[model samples]
Target: MRAAIAGSDAVRGTTSPNPPVGCVILDAEGNQVGLGATQPPGGSHAEVMALVDAGTKARGGTAVVTLEPCAHHGRTPPCTRALIAAGVKKVVFAVADPNPAAAGGRTVLTDAGVTVESGLLADEVELGPLRAWLHYARTGRPHVTWKYAATLDGRVAAADGTSRWISSEESRAQVHDLRRRIDAIVAGRGTILADDSALTARSADGTADGTSVDRQPLRVVVGTGDLPEGARVLDDAAETLHLRTREPSEVLAALGERGVVDVLLEGGPTLAGAFVQAGAVDRVLAYVAPTLLGDGPVALGASGVSTITGAHRFRVEGVTMCGPDVRISAVPDRN
Candidate 1:
């Protein structure tokens, strides 16, 4: 299970909206026969790749996959059919499909006389692979992961608003890769005006056209305020999606209806806080640098809690170092 889940990290930035899954097939002697991962939305599925690698060796073997085999056909054939054809005799998994069409993989396998066991390291497996999908299934909108850069003391910028290079080049490249996976990237009016961010989903080859290929994530800005005339997002008039909403749920719901399944919020403090306070934030990814900027914009919007005694709590999900900075992620307690 650990190996299956670990394989998901290799394709994080490209899998957006789609949950990343990993699979491993082992023969009777417990020697690995095949290994694979979910490619993209409509590409080869994890089990197909693993079965392909396993080939004829898959017969009578055990297949351990991080997520349940998908039961229905969509971009690819149903994975249950692949496993059965490959002759995998037993299956073990960490999660079940919540999608209506995919809800009965284990049932189908059981009816076919295959043994199945589930929930081995389920939480960790889900976090690594099914995070975006689970978040979307629960809220009916794209999973929103608010990404930001801040000082060690949690300042996003100085009092003068001269924020630059909070993290290293390596980290910025990593962020861009994140840009490619999601259906859209959003910013507040302030970020759009101040940064003049293109808000386009850029990749190594070129920028998304917002039409042909996933519609370029619908470049979005939230505001009632006006943006500068020369801003890049404004320059491409037909390409931008502007939402004038004071409420988070209203805007998110509209986006969800359009098939947007994941959103990366690279917006300003007020907007980020609005999302968090509204219980709209699904994940928080912050890059904390080593220096302290003191009285600048804090990592989050200012709220009066009167001390540590008064606070809204969230759980730390994971932490990793990017160049000289540390990235911290958290999820709200569903309990």
Candidate 2:
């Protein structure tokens, strides 16, 4: 199950809207035969790929999968049919499919005389690779993670607005890795005009030259404004979309239409505040440096909170150190 979960995490950014599932096949003697992860949209799912890898060895074998094998047909045939045809004897899955159209895989497999077991390492799979997709499936919207970097005093930049290198090199590299694992990276017009960031996921060593990695997330610019000519974001590094609106919900709706299940919100404070005020941000990833800059803009702005009681509260999920910076992960305390 852990191997299956790792396989699912390996292909996070490629599969959006569809859950990035993982599967492993063990022969009748309980020896590992094959392993595979979900491919891109409209492609074969994890189980089919693993079955293909196993070939004749899949007969009378057990299949370990991260998600319940999909029962309904969409872009491809039902995974349950593939498993039955493959002659898989037993199925062990970590998480159940929440989408009604894709549920009931266990029942179908059981009726076919295949042993089915679920909830093996369910918590690990849910909190790791399946977190964003599950949230999207339950809410019918893209899951938003608002990421920012600031000083100890809560300032994003110095007094003169010349902001650069607020976090350590380790933190920046970690953010690049995170960008590569999400569906889209969203920034506001203000951020583009101020920083002219390419928003492309780059190799850690290539960060200085703006060289993009092979698989880059979609670059989404929000707000109704004309981008400057020859902007780096307009280059052929990755796909770019300029959304002509400042409404957070509108932006999310458009991205959702494009099959974006997870979104990384890297916009400026105003844009972040807008999303927070709209209750659109689902997670928060903040990097705080040790230095103090008391005279610049804070990490967030005007989030519709006029009093202490109205404050947008969040529960800290984790705190870790990245070089000299402190990384904090949290989610809204809607409870």
Candidate 3:
């Protein structure tokens, strides 16, 4: 199951509207025979690839997968049918498919006399690769992770408004990697006017690798503010969306209509405050540098919280060192 989870990570960003699944095939003697991960949209599913690799070894073998095999047919036949025909005697999966259109694989396999078990390492799968897609399934909107880099004292910039180099070079590289895994990256008009960022996911030196980025996430700018014609985001680096609205919910709704499942929110403090006040932010990624700015703009603006009890709160998910900085990941904890 752990190997299957790792395989799912291989194609994380490429598959949209489709969960990245992984599969492992074990012969009756309990020796692993095959392994496979999901491909892009309209491609063969993980189960099919593993079964093909297993060949004759698949007969009477146990198939372990990260997600429950899909039951209904769309671009391809149902994965349940493929597993049955492969003579697989047993199937084990981590998480149940939540998408209503492609669920119920467990019942289908059981009806076909194939033993099926689920919920093996379900928490790990939910909190890891499946986090974004599952959120989309549960809510009719994209999962948003607000990302920001600031100094140790919660300052985003210096008193002179020179905000460059708050975090280390390693932290910036990590942000680029995060951008590559999501469907979109959004910034407010203030950020666009201040930085004019292109928001393209690339290597540290700002050069495209030519292969990994077959498709780049949509670069989005929010608010009714006009941008200069020479803005880097206006170039042909990737597709850009200029949403003339200040409402975070409206922005997410528009992206959802375009089949966006995950979004990296890179907006400024004002925009972040709006999202936080409206309860639209699902996760937060904060990079804290070792330096401190005595007087500067804060990492977040007012979020309608005037008292301690009403303050925005998040549960810490992870904390790690990124070169000379610290990266903290947290999720909304309303309770």
lDDT against the true structure, per candidate, is 0.78, 0.92, 0.89
Tens-digit lDDT track for model 3 on 1-335? 98889888777777777788889999999899989888778998899989998998999999999999999998989999999999999999999988888999999999999999889999999998888888998898889999999998999999998987788889988988888888899999888888777889987656776676566789999999787888989898888999999898899999999888889998799999999999889999999999978998997898999999898889999999999999999999967
What is the lDDT, from 0 to 100, of the residue 62 in candidate 2?
94
Model 2 misplacement above 4 A: 205-212
Candidate 2 lDDT over 1-335, as tens digits, reads 88899989999989997999999999999988989999999999999999999998999999999999989989999999999999999999999999999999999999999999999999999889999999888888999999999999998999998777888889988998999899999999899998889998875544634444558899999989899999998998899999999999999999999999999999799999999999999999999999987798888978899999999999999999999999999999979
TM-score of each: 0.81, 0.97, 0.95
Candidate 1 local lDDT, residue 154: 84
Task: Identify the candidate with maximal lDDT.
Answer: 2
Compared with the true structure, model 3 gives a TM-score of 0.95
Worst 10 residues of 2 by lDDT: 204-213
Q: Give one digit per residue, the lDDT tens place, for model 1 in 1-335.
A: 77788776555545545667889999867889999888877788888988998989989998999888988888789999889888889999988877776769999899888899999889886676567767776657778889998888888888898886677766776776677656678789888877777876554234544453343456778988777778888765336778888468877987777666778898688888788777778888888889887777776674334588556677898899988989889887766
Supply candidate 1's per-residue lDDT for 31.
Answer: 84
lDDT over C-alpha atoms for residue 135 of model 1 = 72
Top-TM-score candidate index: 2
